[model samples]
Target: MPFYIRARTYFKYAEEQMSLAEKEKDPEKILKFTLEAAERAVRALWAIVQVEAPKEKPPLEKILAEIDKACEPDLAEEIKNHVRRIKELAQNPSVEAAKEALILSRQVVRRTREVLEPIIGPAKRVDQHRRFYF
Candidate 1:
């Protein structure tokens, strides 16, 4: 099966297990289901990274986490700069800087999407897009 399908199946099973655990009030069952969900999500992302990234990179989750951490501050800085640039450009609009900023913003989005896709699936991917777009 495709990684996405497999991930979804595991997620379904985990959700069912969690529901059962809730009904039974069994803590162990809750832990089991939670672990299963995390494992399946990690596995799915690992598969995607295998396909999308070059070899010699770190493991998928580690790399993703590191990249995510690294990007957080940069993204914040970019947003701040963007606001300033937009205001400045409003007064003295520099097409070149705006274009460069736009390009960098796209790169951030693309990198984030690559890290997020297998973990969250399509609906969440769309949600992320919407969240970031606005």
Candidate 2:
């Protein structure tokens, strides 16, 4: 599939996972879903730029550094910082961390969707009646 399509897929999944993360009571499960949302959001960002994202959970800072080193123009500082915060919060999952993760994931995913919409078309009218309300 094309990078745009992949980006949309990840963006959708990340949003779905975020919903689960929000209602979760267990810290581990919260972290699991939070990390998934964060990683998938990062993947969407990479795909929007037509590049491959890391499959492993190496430090997000390392991955961002690699992107900065390789991509012609790095992702906006806003995205980089959000992703870094996500990684930091994921380390020690707790009620507070989960709250922060949800906030961070929401911002990053919303921004990714905005940046991708013009290139790949708006996500408002997607199939299956599934909406991504960032």
Measured by lDDT, the strongest candidate is: 2
**Runs off by more than 4 Å, candidate 1:** 1-24, 52-134
Clashes of each: 0, 0
Per-residue C-alpha lDDT of model 1 across residues 1-134, encoded as one tens digit per residue: 45445444544453444344345333344334333333333333344434343445354346334332323556534433433443343343344543443343333333433545556455454777777543
TM-scores of the candidates in the order shown: 0.32, 0.68
What CA root-mean-square deviation does each model show from the true structure?
17.2, 5.7
Candidate lDDT scores, in order, read: 0.41, 0.70
Model 2, residue 35: C-alpha shift (Å): 2.0
lDDT of 2 at 93: 77
> Clashes in model 1: which pairs?
none
Local accuracy of candidate 2 as per-residue lDDT tens digits, 52-105: 554664555555655443233444566678777777777887888878877877
